[model samples]
Target chain A: MAYALMIHPTDNVAVVTEAVRPGEDVLYEDANGGQVCLKAAGDVPVYHKIALRDIAPGEQVLKYGKTIGVATAPIAKGEHVHCHNIESPERKELI
Target chain B: MEFYGYRRSDGRVGIRNHVLILPASICASDTAEMIARQVNGAVSFHNQVGCSQVPSDMQYALDMMAGLAANPNVYGTIVVAAGCETCQCGMVMDAIAARTNKPLHGLIIQKEGGTIRLIEKAVRLAREMAAEASTLRREKFPVSELILGTECGGSDPTSGIAANPVIGKVSDALVADGGTVILSETTEFIGAESILADRAKDEHVRRRILEIVERYEQHFIRNGENVRLGNPTPGNKEGGLSTLEEKSLGCIHKGGESVIQAVYDYAKPIPTDVKGLVIMDTPGNDASSIAGMLAGGAQIVVFSSGRGTPLGSPIAPVIKITGNDATFRMMEDNIDFNAAPVITEQKKPAQLGEALYKMVLDCCDGKLSKAEALGFTETAVMRACNYV
Candidate 1:
């Protein structure tokens, strides 16, 4: 089993440190030793994002324990998060 | 680990051994270049500054010239001047003397009579300096003596995820080993000022960080441009970065998690003992920023790019690293390190960071970087007023 890892618990997503192919078991351990297992949705590349929790519109997306952007729509856990679902506050016009 | 470096009489270690011909004004650049052309192991930048209106600007030019001469990389320097510029040869020579007691000679164009005479005198002086410089031998120096500058340019979406953070990790590793790291480019720190400020050692340092950001914004205001009128640049937009804040957030990662120690003006020498990370107040122009860092005593630079750039400095070695796989593939010759594995494949930032650290060691140990191998020796000093 392979899994993306988060540097900080406050992070909204875990970075795919290794390529996770579809159907591969992905295990995530929370702060309290709680574990969650999910199958990889696809072959996610390194440094790419994998959602840890469902995010709603206008929600601040956290990465590296800091706000990277605000979510523009609801995103499911394990979904790839990027420019498609989030927008920089400075250039909201682009969104 | 140690690298073979030229140990200056002033106790500073230099990675490169060269004789420098420094022009005190724009009028003397050609003469200096000609002199450098006549002598082997001599290098000079075609600078367009030094003769300026404002006293402060003149001081900046003088300081930059003096700093370059005093840099550990140069064994000796020959300053060439027109004798009428605001930054006179005497003044430049005095500044260099104040900093280091390295071998220095001066040639004044007007005092030497004419262009031909000036070139001849400069070449003779440069030849002598080059010969003297060539005698100095490399000695072993600890990695802690290294002052590394970190910068990002031509950034794309992958920069934040891969290259920047990887450099950040390298920064942290260097700092942990007691080496100094300079994180610069004031404009890139605009939106992320508060985040960086929070990492400052104290409230005073935190306030200073904010002040520097405000000062940069004031520059745009004085120029009649909106402060937030979009600053990710056209290249950044083309590479998938949309906004200044987003770019800023990515840029701050280069500082790593180290405490912000001090802030300095353009081309000002950083405090040698100040360990961990410090920020130099410099423009977003890659060449100008790198010049400032080099002037501040950085012996090497780690430049990250998502869109890729082949920029290098004349004095210090610039190691180009990229995050975007496409850009890395497209500009293979320019980039020295492929940080793209952290994005396209599955390398961890720390893993890549360790690799970069090893590369730094290799670079320090006389391994020729792509920039060095390409013979790229670009140099620029930030000037206040625009050149016509």
Candidate 2:
């Protein structure tokens, strides 16, 4: 298994163990025991995250079972999830 | 449940025994260091902050100086003053006396006549103190007596993935054993403040946690700077942390799942009765945040890192743990624990936590850590703002 970890059951992202080249097979068993296998759509570098499922723009991106950010653009399964595609709303504003 | 350490006169326990040469201001710091170098078993850290400052900054300086003096790691303290600084020799000594009854001595350069006389007198005193400190022997003390400080710097994805969560487990274990853990760096709580507040035992503590996070945010906004710009850090950004929220989400895992009991100002000593997790409002700078916890009474510090930094304290043993196996192998001399196996499923968080807890005990019992073996001891007093 060119494996990745789904940290929290609520997370929609999986952090890859090593760099995954485009079109390579990747498997994920999410927190709810949801099994997923897909061909990588983009190069996912080591320690970087990938979408476990399709996410709509403005949807919350979950990691560590918490809201790490909101997606800036529509994200597909196996696509790389990075700063360019997400925004941290809470971190950007202060009361 | 117990480890060998030096039992202080004030009923506190210490993992190391040294005679500390404490400089009252930046001016006297060099002199203080010289004195420490001349005496074996003596250590000193220079004060880099300008002595003359506004009230709040002065308060931080005084409190941190006193905290370093009162730290259980020191067998005695010799406060050296440049004679005309805002923090006077006698006043600093009195402040330290209020906290710990361990041996303390005061010196003034002007009173002693000149640099030659001051250095001579300081060295003589330091040598005597070191000799006295050497005569002390380590005694076994219950682990419950421990006050732990937790911090992170140069964070990355593995910070949340393995390093910090592993520490969170250690925090829970320590708290379960009736010890105290100080979770710090107020800036890191920007996005995850509410999640942390939920872990507070009561509304009061929760409110204070939120309040400090706001205060830090506002402090930046008032100064016309975005807190996000410097946070998450360049190394953090490169290592897959996208934003401050993502970094903070990982950052807070150091506190584990224990309920926060109280919130404290930077450098204020934590009350002995509070045995669970506590938050000390501190800056994001690695050394400054750690210093705040040290002054607040953390006998040992477990610093989680991903990109890796070599920050150590003269008064506390900093055990650096990392989940980035590459960083660990690259900086093995600075890092003490490699928790990367958690991400690989080779080791469970609880198992690594137990192993780390044992390392903590062994460190307390005089197992020299990587930082200590390399003789890396650094400290800095965190100021609320720049000097006026």
User: DockQ numbers for every candidate?
Assistant: 0.13, 0.55
Q: List residue ranges in candidate 2 displaced over 4 A.
A: A90-95
Pairs of residues at least 3 apart in sequence or in different chains that clash in candidate 1 = none
Candidate 2: Cα lDDT at B228: 88
How far is B87's C-alpha from truth in model 2 (Å)? 2.3
TM-score for each candidate, following the candidate numbering: 0.84, 0.96
**Candidate 1 residues B1-388, lDDT tens each?**
6778988888888999889899888898878888888999888887768886477677678778888888888888989998898888899999999988989888888888988988877787778878787787778888888999999989876788789999999999999988899999988887678889989989878888888888777767788885456567777765655456667878888888999988888888876777889988887778878888888888899999988898887677899998888788999999988888875676889999999999988898778789878877677776666542
Per-prediction interface RMSD?
7.3, 2.1
Model 1: DockQ vs. true structure: 0.13
Instruction: Evaluate residue B180 in candidate 2 and report its C-alpha lDDT on the 0 to 100 scale.
Output: 91
Residue B296 lDDT, candidate 2, scale 0-100: 84
Error of 2 at B121 (Å): 0.9
State the lDDT of candidate 2 residue by residue for B1-388, as single tens digits. Answer: 8889888898888898989899898898888888888998888887876377888888898899888888888899999998888887887888899999999999998899977899998889888988888888888788888999999998889988899989999999999988999999998998899898888889888888888998888888899988888887788878888878888988999999988999999999887777888999999888888888888878899999999988898778999999999999999989999999998765888899999999988998999877777777788878777766
The per-model lDDT (C-alpha) reads 0.81, 0.87
Off by over 4 Å in 1: A1-95, B227-230, B386-388
